[model samples]
Target: MAYKDQKLSEEKVFKDPVHRYVHVRDRVIWDLIAAPEFQRLRRIKQLGTTNLTFHGAEHSRFNHSLGVYEIVRRIISNFENRPHWNNEERLLCLCAALLHDLGHGPFSHSFEKVFKLDHEYFTQQIIIGDTKINNILEKVSPGFSQKVADVIAKTYKDKLVVSLISSQIDADRMDYLQRDAYYTGVSYGHFDMERILRVMRPMEDQVVIKSTGMHAVEDYIMSRYQMYWQVYFHPVTRSAEVILSKILHRAKELYESDDFIFKLKPTHFISFFEGKVKLEEYLKLDESIVHYYFQLWQEEQDDILRDLCERFMNRRLFKYVEFNPNLQMKQWMELYQLFQDAGIHPEYYLVVDSSSDLPYDFYRPGEEEERLPIHLVMPDNSLKELSRHSDIVEAISGKKRTDHKLYFPKDRLDAVEDEQLKHRIIEILYGQGEVKDVR
Candidate 1:
């Protein structure tokens, strides 16, 4: 048999906590899993800084990636005998699903914010560039690697294949919602996934749900909404994220300072600080490698860098209070100066973090990031958008909910020896004459 047509004599099954078992029969998938590029995911956490909040959320991207592939595999199995489901696209969909998150760096979102790097771009490079994964994909056909990349990029001509992985209710979201919930030990992510899968119908360009499964889809949507607020956007998780992003920023700032000399050179971060990271260099800096640097930087001469590292390594996280952007603009400015007066560097010390989620949204013309809403197949075989059919979905559809918080090290504010300065700052922060900062 040709390389692409090769299969193992017996199926290989990985015991998964979420899926129970992830079965592999295709040689291509087994090889891809073993590839060094894909294996790097084991070191990258699925939910960055979240593990610090929920100890059980120590799962890695490798775990979630495998779960995504398994979900897609089951989905495709259902699609096989159905009309409009092309068997030829099966391998492409499977590969795309598995490799979709291949390029996520350690503490992915925080790293991206600090370094201006896009994981999706790196994922495309991994698929098409000089790498073991690219070689495996190229073995399938001359341009097969690019085809996989395009599918991931959502530019593939086969919109049906694209929807299977990238759509709002597709395998990627389905897997992560359950997997993240499982790892975090939260009840919000639970939903009737089996029913959703059973009701899935492949269309010419997309997947539609049978009207019978509308309730199940609604449950999934609400589960996602609850998970975002309760687990994904937990204030504690955001606190750690704020500190992590600051550590990256402080390190980058010191790297660019001409007068500053590192007692120990930041070898792992030099490329990232310079904004010209090579693919190999990017691959080399996983979570363990980042933690190693964080440990060493704890002893650095730079007080800000050393202090931030200590806070992250020891879990001395910043405390946050709800922030109203419209009303608190002036208050925030005054507090910024008060922080500076108290010898706390406002730049690194005070940060406003905002998180927003749109549980479901229909297509909006000319919007930069358009969400293709879920559709339901009616009894008469007509298709209707999910929000139109379900009152529950309609209640929150297209209406984005946003939360903002101002995060700062309350311990540092407490250590401010200037009693009046502390009291005044506390007064603004807590609206009390007492100096203690209230939660």
Candidate 2:
């Protein structure tokens, strides 16, 4: 009840590119951001190895977290006088948005793949465990931390609040879709977020976009579609991920093998390899620490370890070409043998990367794991599923688009003077003509 009247004497502001200025007027919100656990977001890149491709995408999760929080703040501010909007849930929404990504570690997706770590688990830990975030949340009310976690976990009883953060067109998607686009300098992610936010309405158990704003909703869905293919699932990004995964795997293998002696001994990677990493150890890891290991490993005695590290650090990304798995199986095998004959390890050099996404899905009744589909509030007060009314959404709804690429080091192939072997490999990769830039 005290929070109803509580506000910071001097509002805190974070200069943000996406949101312009993220303002915090609540004492609890300001304290939550200052918490060491939340501040750790500064070390984690928002797009991981994406900075390798889009150099401007060097922004951190801290930037995104603040942007998400600002978006939620604006949404709550907009919903203040709307029907079915509870003033009590305002702080909870803001807290959930600010702390949602607190659990993300350095290169979250790649680290999680290698170590099997769950950032969501750590997200709940930071809020509910004995940490600064927990202490701050508890100050608001007993069990407030759990309440905040519930909202993030999407199990909060108030579906409206859940929808605000996790729905098809919520603040989380709204912020990232635009923020990532801005940082990546891509035109596809441009959507009228202001128009979308203005048209948002809180309904029973869900949020809906007014039918008049259907075009805006269509734009948002299309933006998501483009961002997914053009940015999130870019083959080059996946290629980088493949190389990173191999680097981690190689380090783990070396640590297990008696032949390998690391210069730094890979102390940070030990617990991860042994599958007993502590939260504190995990927190110590950032891109810098990982890069430190990679830099040292460049001078490692093991060729595989040194090569992978050098390739990753120097941006010598694996080259890729379109290939079907079933049809190209024989060619892939021959390429592998060719690489072996050429003294290059086929395992590391040859890779196939694929990425896919379902842009939108209409709610299917009786489906156990159905997502609450986006609904357009019609002029006559009836509601329609997004795809039913919007042509673009209809074109992409439940449509899974996929892209596959065969990756290899083209620079290595170009230097090979073995005309017979080089031609065979090049023919397999590029078919007839030279491989052009996929972009």
Candidate 3:
């Protein structure tokens, strides 16, 4: 059969919790979804360690990927027949949206930090590499796979299409905000996504919002702000991420040590342990594989590895105290020594985790990742950068809010044999000594 034969006779739809239904047309997209690489997303949690805090945030990357594709599908439908919009790019946009999160491994944030792997790099690799996804896209059209990969990498010549997949307010964020809100059962992610889509207009270079939909747009900006703090940056979630990162760090240390021997071989992570991982090895990992390894590490001879593995596998995560590394250097050092003196590996036990977000921007020409600021197209065909006209977004525009929390195994700290040392540690963390950094 010819490459052009990859078009479906009927549309296929998926029932999604965030969007009622995610519709797919064309055999290329259908085949891409069935590819093993894309299906692997089903086992990787979207929020990573957030489920430890929210309990219901067990949604997978596959779930968010489909929702993003569905949003783009609707956006394209709205742009159809409109000037400056090219129907030819529709399939490319859909494929990129569906495969954007393809490279996320188990516990993505911690995994990426410990291994220094970029999920985005792996994402492009999967699209253009010798994988089933690449094969399907190539069959659709020669160079088609590269086009999808480029759109994801933000290097595609078509800025308009790239903006749809990634921008200050694009389909990816829109879908995840609402979908994450729904799964976590939090009211913060609620926003008028349908209204925002209705008001979106395809322009010469980027997608812009209609002036009339400014309120809906403001609500979106605000929704993102709340979700970041309430759900994404919640200290409890960061605690789990801290422990998870430490586990990876501890394992890597043991892997490099001549004295350390593993009771359970880290076969899947051998490449990572060597400081680099091939695409094939990276793709083999999912949340289930990580869980299996953690369970096995619980039986390891290393006290630190065994304890951390048990804590993570059993959800007995570290407890956190808010602290500023800049201002509280003395206190941080004191506690670091206290843990060490108490017979705990302070490196794994004491952790400082920070998360930050810029709610909105007013289009700085060459700075700040150059996120195309949201533009409100007025009735006179005039374009005003979002923060100028919307008071709600203007208040927080271009401002970066950051949260920091110090994580440690509280149960172990409480078991310290020295009563005076324990009292001193508690006084600095909880009493009048709290750091004044307002997130």
Candidate 4:
């Protein structure tokens, strides 16, 4: 038998918390799971810094990836022998699903933000680059690896395949919602995924849900909305994220300083600091390596680096207040000057973090980052966009909600010996007579 067509001697199953059991039968899938590059996901957290807030959210990307693969597997099982569902693309879809998050770094989003890295770009590179993953994919076919990369990058000619893995209601979202919800021990992410899956129909260019399942789809969309606020965007988790980003920023700043020398060399971060990270150098970094540096840097001579690292490593997170930048520019300027006057480095100590989400959006052509809206197949076999049929979806459809918070070291503000300066700063931050810990 061709290597690409080979099956495992016996089915292997991973007992999963959310999915119960993740079954693998293909030899290719088994080998891909055992590949060193895929195994690296074990060290990357599914929700960076969220475990600090929700103690149970310590599950790794490896766990989530397996869950995603299982979801796609079940989805394909339902698609078999159905019209508009091409069976030839099954393995490609599975491989793409399993390897979708291969390039996520330690504290993935923070590292990406600080270093201007794209995990999706790195994901494609890993599939096409010189790596174990590439070698295994090459054994499948001459250019099979590229196919997987295109599927992940959402550039494949097969829109149906791309939709299956990446649409508004695809396996990736389905798995993470439940998986993250399960790990975080939250009730919000729960939805009837089985019903949604059962009603899924593969169309010429996309997957459509049977109108009968519109209620389940509504629940799923609402679940995603709630998960964003309750778990993924928890204030405490955001505080930790702020510290992690600052730690990376400080490390890069110190690395670029000509006079500074590290007490322990930041060898793992050299390429990233220089902005020319090779694939191998990128892979060498994981949470363990990052934490090792954070712990050691807590003792560094550079006070900013030491302080930020200590905060992240010990969870001495900055406190925040509701802030609107446009209306409070004058207040912000005054606060910035006051912080400087008080001998606090405003650059590192003061931060404005904003988060926004569109719970659901109708399709809009020519829009940047346009997401294809979920479509429902009616009883008469006509397709209609979801928001048109559900009042619940229409209410919030295309409406973007945003929030901004200004994070600062409240402990530092309290320590100011100048009573007049301390009270003034507090008054500006919290308004008159409203001084309190917002955390």
Task: List TM-score per model, in order.
Answer: 0.95, 0.92, 0.94, 0.96
Report the candidate with higher TM-score, 1 versus 2.
Answer: 1
For candidate 4, list the clashing residue pairs, or say none: none
Residue 308's lDDT within candidate 1 is: 96
lDDT of 3 at 329: 81
> Model 4: residues >4 Å from true position, as ranges?
356-369, 398-400, 432-439
| Clash pairs detected, candidate 3 | 8-27
Per-model C-alpha RMSD = 2.7, 2.9, 3.0, 2.3
What are the per-residue Cα lDDT tens digits for candidate 3 across 1-439? 6654556778889998788998877777788889999999999999998888898999999999999999999999999999899998988899989998898888877887888888899999999999999999987889999999999999999999999999988999999899889999998889988999999999998999999999998998888888877888777777778888898999999999999889878999899889778899899988898899999999999999999999887888877777777778877778788878778888999877766421222323224545568898999999988888877777876577775777777788789889998888777777424433221
Clashes of 3: 1
Q: Could you give candidate 4's per-residue lDDT for residues 30-126 as a string of tens digits?
A: 9999999999999999998889889899999999999999999999999999999999999999999999999998888888889999898899999
lDDT per residue (tens digit) for residues 86-171 in model 2: 98899999999999988998877877877788888888887898888898898888999999999999999999999988888888
lDDT of 1 by residue, 199-256 (tens): 9999999998999999999999888878877887788888888899999999999989
Which has the higher TM-score value, candidate number 1 or candidate number 4?
4
Candidate 3 structure, TM-score to reference: 0.94
Point out where model 3 deviates above 4 Å.
1-6, 357-369, 398-400, 431-439
- Lowest lDDT 10-residue stretch of candidate 4: 357-366
